[model samples]
Target chain A: MGHNGKMIRKKDLTFLQKSYIPEILKGMRQTIAEMFKPKFTFRYPEERFRPNPSFRGRPVLVQENEVERCVACGLCSRVCPALAIEVQASETELEKERYPIKFEINMVRCIFCGFCEEVCPEEAIVMSNEYELVFSSQEEALFGKDRLLKSAEELKPRLEFLRLNR
Target chain B: MQSLLLISALKFVAFVAVVLLTVIMLVYAERRVSAFIQNRLGPNRVGPWGLLQAIVDVVKLLLKEDVVPRNAYKPVHDLAPIISIAVALSTFAIIPFGNTINVYGHEVKLMIADVNVGILYLLSITSLGVYGVTLAGWSSNNKYSLLGGLRSSAQMISYELSMGLSIIGVLMVSGTLRLDQIVLQQTKYLWGWMPAWNFLLQPVAFITFVVAAFAETNRLPFDLPEAEPELVGGYHTEYSGLKFGLFFLAEYANMITAGAVITTLFLGGWHLPFAENLGLSPLMLSLLQVLTFCVKMFFVMMFFIVVRWTIPRFRYDQLMNIGWKLMLPLTLVNVLVTGLVLLLIQ
Candidate 1:
């Protein structure tokens, strides 16, 4: 979307434009004015940024009542491009009948692509707004079921977003 | 005589300490001002408003390994930053910070050195600064460094002409080469109100001189030598640790000296307007004069930082064109006009 058209030649400039001083003064005034404008930088740790619901952060499994919403169908694990998700299905006495006995996510490999969330047949996995992820070692990066699961109330916004969109 | 020598030594120590401290503050100010202009908070973590960041940075640099490139010439590479820092620091000795005040029954002049040929000393000392950058570039054995050094030499030499010519306008008006005398000339009231500062008397010279100073100092818009995107740290590309820190210190020191020089020559150095009539004590007045000089120098430094953030670097051809075709001729004409006006008034 560009025109390979006429370019401004030196001769085309007016006396003011040719001088460069006026333009420089104009720019200086603009910069001086800009110095007073409120800054956009978050003071980071002290002042955290609250990202909008649309923002796709780290993927977390949604837990409802006393159990996770996942049916252990392996759809999410199969769809995870990074192969970060690991789920072991086991028979449950609850109404869902089958549940993941062992659910782990290698946070290091998780791309946060939301693909696993999209491919989930159950309304189980969703992207949460927890962007600050730091791990000291490879082992530290691996999330077990305890870390991976977020109570449905905690992930209400994301769950609601997925439900409304679907 | 011994007391005079001791006093001079004390002044030397005091001034160098102040200059070093100011350079650190100037670096921090430059970063903060640039960030403010760009709508971001820069380096506010190290201390209160990041005031101690530069001090911490110096310590960090000191602790880091002194890296020397395998292909680099050892002796000159070691010598360059020393030369730059030394030249930058020495230029400030001639700038009068206040009028002579009685200290312990002997009159002590405010500046470190009272050179009779102060202006000539300033010009010569500043001219030597180019050697440090040029030598740094040449010794590094890096193509980018060499280009930066070569550009710096060319820019400095070209701008030096206009800088000297512009100073001639001030010289003609003041009718003296001594910096203190020039300042004294400026303190006189024109029409009983406005100070007859060289900036007011020779505005064209002020403009040209300020422009040439910008070029000489290697600040942005005239910073072709250290254009980071092109030259990758310019002459200091191969320098690291303490050597790199010295160069950084020298650049900021050069800026302070330039600001001091400008304040001395044009803005009426240490001459706080109408303070003599305020009925203040001589000691208080003297202290206030020194304070005035510092405030003026600070504003000039701020202007330098602001201009750096505002203007984009000139194209190499445009830099040369401005230096030779525009600035040189303008300064020559300004000098001529100043001479004519002086003659007419007389």
Candidate 2:
């Protein structure tokens, strides 16, 4: 029985060696076929290749009226996962309203969760489809009131009507 | 003297044209090949099938800012890539791309210089390629750069031994160190069917050589030097714009060099499969031979791309073990076996 076991072991070794060469050849064949496989790179400038509508992009503040939607509620600041949003409010003449005097959203801190958009009661903030937000410095990443207001104005036309009514 | 000077100048210009054109087209091919493998469309928006993308890329690279890192060892860091690019361009001087052709009533050899020790010269210069990688890594002074340089040094030294050993088997059978002579020796066939390609006769040596060449070129599976995720840019993380472009250029140039060397040594450079002794005119045969050499190189290059996409990269330890344990021992045994066979036949 020991002798038979030794014979079986030797046969197994032979089989293993024989199997490797053909398996390796099979791998080579697969690689040759992959030479003709389709590539993954997308042409950026032309053919736009727009992402799906559900594709999450850079977040921007949506101004519902000529007034800022933040209303200094600070709920966005509270719910912010990255603590990106900051709101400094003061009383205003329009219906005893509180408006953010100094509003800033640090884009580097943004997780693009749309959480701030969901958390807003006034429906003032919504993230638009403008995903191209590349910057060379940290300062540029911190969008201040002026920059955010300008971006909000640019996105004002695209905001939904129900949110506008709110 | 003036006419002689003019002739030599023209030859130089012609070599430059071919090398530059090849680099551009090869870049395009690499992009297209990679795109195909990843299931995406390559640069098709430019000219036909993105042919002009390479030209546009070159122009853009040239016009881009050449930023030198403030912390870098400036002179050495700057010169390292230049040395690499120069060496890559210069190595072509010894490679014979085609047969003699007449231009302006002057007969010129296709090669720049066919030295007696052409193979050794090729090896020596090719080995120096590691220095560029090492210096770029070290000079950058970043931890990632330092690691990249250190890995490259170890990797190049380990693989060079195996690469050298692989060629020894071919040298023993061919009985020459000269590349031109090696090609001449490969012209004859062993039987009516076999094409005298060294790959058939010494499969072990061919495999070792090809694998070692992959390592030598710092290609994938052996591309630990620039392993991106782990090392960021690896040796060249600090370099930006055209300075970075030089390292990129050197990588492709080395790929081309490796392809050419493999073609000349094993695949029967420029010789047709089974068409030897047909009594064709020397000029006509030479032309056909050049075309054959190109086809072989192209096929080998495609093999490089395929392996790159198909195989996952080797871990550093795994790469080291394969080089020293598997490839080195196997190559040495191959060399010994080939030498013994040659001795017995003689």
Candidate 3:
């Protein structure tokens, strides 16, 4: 006979299995064993998960030499599906001629899709590992330029991961 | 007469308080056990190891707004939860937790009522519990509630027959409907080693009764009435706040009652092996016996929780088939065989 596609066969149950008691006992045994197994739950606020380089948390503007790398191209704002990011560009004397006078990301509106980071031409806005975002009021959730800026040293691992992977 | 009344009233108050406390603990245990079974730590935030979680839950429930549906039958809606809770609490009156204890130079029976027809009273009161569910469903005036109510009543009625019949084997052997007497009868041993509990003597009846108890309590494998996927909260769909809390408390209370009844009937209630030979004082012995009963009931409650997490819910048709075809016939056979064996021995 010629070999065809993989044929899956259902294993036949013996008298004990057919009776349901054995299977039920086996399941109960498994569950009781699982009860003693080590749990994977993190205490959350008190305990935090350290995300790897590829992990996309809040999008942040990389600050190198106490100056933001962003030229305020407005690419991130255009690519943001949620329209959460808003950038107002102004003239600057630095090598990057244009700088954001006001750059704000609405944390509540952000879906954390990493589109802003992916579309940033300057590699300025990159996803950091800081996932803890708590806001009691609407105004508090709006991340201004001061809140959005991160020291390049802090986001080195993510930048390295991006460089290596991309 | 005055003393008797006072004692009875005191017993009632004590029993109610104890039952409410047990219900709270049982809720906590259910969450913890279920979490453990699923490989998760449950509710360890409220107090040390989440001991105060139940209290927090009670507070939350109390603080919630009591929402009644606009088109609901207001009287029945209000009455249903009260009726459910009342029936659940009332059934505990007949369960003998321990033998008599001497308190203040007077002998007091551990149970609230030592009624001769204890088991019969239990069966009748449990049957009345169906009314609460049915009324809740009907009064909600929702299709899901109505269906849930109908399913619950049907399931209860079907399982109650087997549950009642299964006990006939035990009743015949023990020769009494009094729960305390049944426990007393279970104190004997067979072949000088094995305890002659009804569970060992009539295994078939025991299995049937346990299954029936699960169905009666609306636990998993028999929780068709409140099938969350299909019924969307089932009969208590329209219930909110304290009314929903009553239903929740009533369910746990019923579970505790089931555990107590099972302990009284099949397990040796308050009877520890070789305890009589221990030579302890009468007060100490009675206390130990009460402790033994509580331990047995606690294990039963744990078994209920474990089995709930272990098994999947049965489909409606499968539930009916098992109740009527499988459990009913097996119980009948058990009764017949028990009667035959008794006759032969005589």
Candidate 4:
């Protein structure tokens, strides 16, 4: 446009486009039509979202036959990017021989990255579907085995999903 | 004289109450409409379909801290929003909501004030609305606010000319300055079929006037004054709590005034098509006429809200170009043609 009033535009707008009123009316028509269409919003309190099996929510230790599948190898703690998991190994009479006696996952620091679940040698830790993790204090957010462990039957879909994919 | 005073007081109370309520409702409608356009549900939790959201929002604003900048000129900052809301509300005084209605054997005009020079009052008062924005910007000692104030004043000046010229065509067609008389003139049927609305009679004037109205109201496609990306809330950058709430109410109030003005001038104010021939009583007809006026204003207000979300803000240069180059000349031509046509018809 700087070439001494010579036109540099590749395409010239039509009279209607230059006037812009018709184009504006057209846009208004589109918007008004869109108003009658369905809205994509969840009424959060009354309605809830159900995530898929592939969805990684909160991380929990898988429990099999009333015992945790974790071998207390500290691989999940080592792999946790947020440093949310803490594990203390103690010899047990069970066949797994070693289990986490002081197993805790800080809900506040857990970023839901699923890295800890991926790094576990024994499919012991897996992301669960229970995503509504509300904590009043930092101490309250440090989830112990009581809160972090889920039964194998309860997490069957995610386990099945892991089996099918991996 | 006592009865006259009583009726006037009643009308004043009713008008102010309706305007304020409509302002709150307009805010809710804007949010809901914008959400609908974008495929999202907005503010449905406040009340049934979020009907009470705007009222709740006003309460929230009232409860918030009224903050003032340490270096700010405090007096003008306080007075600016008052000026804005006052100007926005006062323009409605001359707008005739309906024809004269008989109440207890007394003829009561449905307007707050029946000023003879209604159009002039409207033009002068609406232009003064810029002072509120300008003073708010200037008093804040914020550069963005200052720029916003400057842009709004310039924008108002440029568009106000076209807005006035567009109305001149309507004035020539109707040949009266009293808004009620103008509305009365529009009640006639042209060629015994078409209702002689100013819009139908002078199409060009209607288009130019509506566009000018959009710009004057500081809505989108001309909201360069408060362009959020560039000016950060524009003149209201420093205002918070109830102070900011007043500006918000003023914006929506200005919108309703514009809608009412547009309806009164161009849309055949309160002249419901063929409603007179329905064998209704005069009192019933007057009531219907009032309702008709409200429905027309509501539709126009809807147009304003929909247009806001439909169009993007104009650049400062583009705004100036349109104001000076396009709308000004267009309205001038429309005025000339209207005058010539009137002369020929006479």
Candidate 5:
């Protein structure tokens, strides 16, 4: 049978395969072997999985030198498919100009698609390796700038990976 | 008569307690074995290596809210799980766990009841287990539950024919229906080397019986009744809280019963080869035999769990074909061959 658009015919099985006994035995043997193999389970709470630099986790505002790198650019908010990010621009005394007076990311609505991070021209809203996002109430899930901001040192690996890849 | 009654009562209590405890541990073992087969760590949080997991589960079940559907038949829904568990637990009564032991001046058998028609009693009681599932399904007023119950009952009936036929070979070989006598017969060695286990003599019957037993217990490769992808939860879909817990307990209990049956019928019960030559006292020997039976039962249970993780559930039509088309005829052939051989030898 051709791999193209042609109709594929079923291959004739060997006597052993047709009988199914050999295949069954082989399967059983494989499973028994797997029983002795090392388990890949990570015991949560006691142990955590450390994601690589390429891994996208929770979105965070990169804080550098006692100030956020974001100039209140609404690009991240506009690109967010979930409509999770909300920003209010305000005048700033800094040379770069406007800053977000109030910025909020509804952790509940955020789909972790990294669209906000991708659209941010300022490189401020990058994904941080903080995957454990638990909130008891709807209000608690609405992350303000206080919770959303992370120091550049904390997000260095992801930022480095992004810069190298881009 | 009073003494005999008292002894029987004591034996019954002991037997039930042992079985219930084993069933609890067997649940934990099933989970752990399944996890190991899939290369994952199972429950290890409740107690030491999760030894107290069963206790925690029982407590959780007892505390959970019991939900009964408005449209469901209340009495039948309530009665179904009780029947399921009762039948499962009752099957152990006729299974001879060990030989007779002398204590002080009296002789005591390890089994609860030494019934003359032990195998017949076992088969009949096990057959009654289908009622529990069927009633549970019919009373639940849910299509999934009804379908599951119907499938389970139909599967049990189909496989049961093969199972019974397979056992006919064992019956013919042993020449006795009494379980203790069957075990005694198995104690004889073939040419002073290999144990005369029925598994050696009736390999085809053993395979068919094992396949049938797997179907009867509703384990994987034959678990079409409770196929989670199709039937949701089969018969116990509508049951919740301890009522659902009862069904879970009943399934594990049935597995243990199946394991015990397989061990008794084919693996030579508790008769260990060359056990007599150890020169141990009668009491010690009886204890050793009981230990042997438990060991064999444990391995059988492990095999059951392993098979569950190894094999995927069969399609409904394939399950039916295997039960009727394949296993039935094969067992019939096994019976005929065994009968012919026995006649020739005589």
Candidate 6:
């Protein structure tokens, strides 16, 4: 549609008139201007810059007292495009409650989509800012409940310190 | 045979050292330049300003498992990158880096070798580099790699014609293919005011040369060979480890070679502006000229990096069409016009 509307008259320059002389001048002028213009480079190492605030990183599981916030809704397992997340729900000891008995996330398969976080009704799963989670083996990346729970425990002191200071 | 063997061995060691050091530093420079352009700090952890980062990366790659895809041709997969790196390094032979210096008892030129047909040698060797890339892509048995190889070969062949033609104009004006002679020609001022560089007399040729050089080097805007979005990993999609590193080294070496050629041809190879007419001493002038050449080369290298960040890649068809249909015809016209002007003025 856009192509049909525009009727542009193109100047037909001859062999010499069109090609040689004009392109030479245009290119030179462009390069000369560029030489003087402020260079678009940042000296790294000595200087550093921050990443965007909302940058999505690795996913983390949240803890509420002794229990997890996840009621094992199974929304994440259904919505995950990569099929990386696994959650199995079973009736818990608490009143009329269900929770994930077997929850495993394969980091290798996970695309960091944040869909899992969005699908969690209890807000049990959240993506943390710690993006540097590389495992040497595939087995290590298959994060089970124990690892997630351990991470939550590790983050407790820092979270509380921030909360109290604020 | 023994003496020849000794000389060859010495030359090989020197050449290997230079190529490795230059590639490492060039990688660091590229990182720093890109970082500065993007307004971000680049590498800094391994050593001061991350000077040792390339080494660390090399070690990491060495330990990495060299993975060849199951369907890939083993022979071509291994041969491609080695050929790429070898051809790129071979061009360094004929480039005269610095003037002769007196050793303990003998005179030595800093350059490794000075072939009389240095320009032709460089062009031919550089042309062979395309074969490595093309073969790598073709033999990979991957669709994307094959497409990339095809695009690279076509683009390179098209631009190669123009690049050679553009330089013919410079060769005509200087009346010599010897790089040293060309630089000498540009040392004198025209009417004691203008620098007697080819850039002034044959500016048309210079532009064509620079643009075509960019294409030949597979730089941005013309970097259709490894257009990441469409070609995925391009010709080296199936390559990994040191094989991949060799390709990376070859690229930087090509950049250096292009910069050196441009300096030698248009910007007065290692010759200071108005050096001949100026009252400076011979030694002082030589030193100044070398420094000038280095500065010019540095600026050209910076231009390569800056342009890479600024411009978007050209479509495959657009790249080919521009090279063959536009640059080729224009360069031919440039030669004709330059010849006419020289004849008329005479």
Candidate 6 matches the true fold with a TM-score of 0.69
Each candidate's number of clashing pairs is 0, 8, 0, 0, 0, 8
Cα lDDT of model 2 by residue, B87-202, tens digit? 78777777766656665676766677768888888888988988898999888989999899899999999999999999988888788887878887787768666667787778
lDDT of 6 by residue, A71-91 (tens): 888898899999988999999
Q: Write the per-residue lDDT of candidate 4 for residues B1-346, one digit (tens) a residue.
A: 9999999999999999999999999999999999999999888978899899999999999999999999999999999999999999999898999989988999999998989888999999999999999999999999999999998999999999999999999999999999999999999998888999999998999999999998999998888889999889999999999999999999999999999999999999999988888999999999999999999999999999999999988877888989999999999999889888888988
Best by TM-score: 1
Instruction: Give model 4's DockQ, 2 decimals.
Output: 0.78
List the lowest-lDDT window of 10 residues for candidate 5 chain B. Answer: B101-110
TM-score of each: 0.96, 0.72, 0.91, 0.95, 0.90, 0.69
Candidate 3 lDDT score relative to the true structure: 0.92
Q: Candidate 4 docking category?
A: medium
Docking verdict class for candidate 1? high
Across B227-293, the per-residue lDDT of candidate 3 in tens digits comes to 9999998999999999999999999999999999998899889989888889999999999999999
For all the predictions, what are the DockQ values?
0.83, 0.31, 0.68, 0.78, 0.60, 0.13
As for DockQ, the candidate ahead, 3 or 5, is 3
For candidate 6, list the clashing residue pairs, or say none.
A40-B37, A41-B36, A41-B37, A42-B35, A42-B36, A42-B37, A44-B41, A44-B42
| Order of candidate numbers by TM-score, starting with the best | 1, 4, 3, 5, 2, 6
Whole-model alpha-carbon lDDT for candidate 4: 0.93
Model 2 stretches with alpha carbons more than 4 Å out: A1-25, A34-166, B1-8, B100-107, B274-282
Per-residue alpha-carbon lDDT of model 5 for B1-346, expressed as tens digits?
A: 8888989999999988888899899989888877888788898888899888987898899999999899999999999999999999999998889999887777888788889998999999999999999999999999999999999999999999999999999999999999989999999999989999999999989989999999988889888778988999899999999999998898999999999999999999999999999999988998999999999999999888878888788888988888888888889998899999999999
Tens digits of per-residue lDDT for model 6, B1-346: 6654566578678867876787788788888666655555567677987899988888887887898888888898889998998898888777665555444544555456767776788889989989999999988899999998998898888888999999889888888887777776887789988878888878878888888888877888788889888889788887888888888889988888888888878887777655556897756666776678778888888777777766678777777777888888978998998789789989
lDDT of each: 0.93, 0.80, 0.92, 0.93, 0.91, 0.78
Candidate ranking under lDDT, highest first, comes to: 1, 4, 3, 5, 2, 6
Question: Which of the two candidates, 4 or 5, achieves a greater DockQ against the reference?
Answer: 4
* Fraction of true interface contacts that also occur in model 1: 0.92
* Runs in model 3 lying further than 4 Å from the true structure: A1-15, A71-78, A86-102, A119-122, A135-141
Error of 5 at B234 (Å): 2.5
Show where candidate 5 strays beyond 4 Å: A1-20, A87-103, A137-139, B65-68
Q: What does the lDDT read for residue B274 in candidate 5?
A: 97
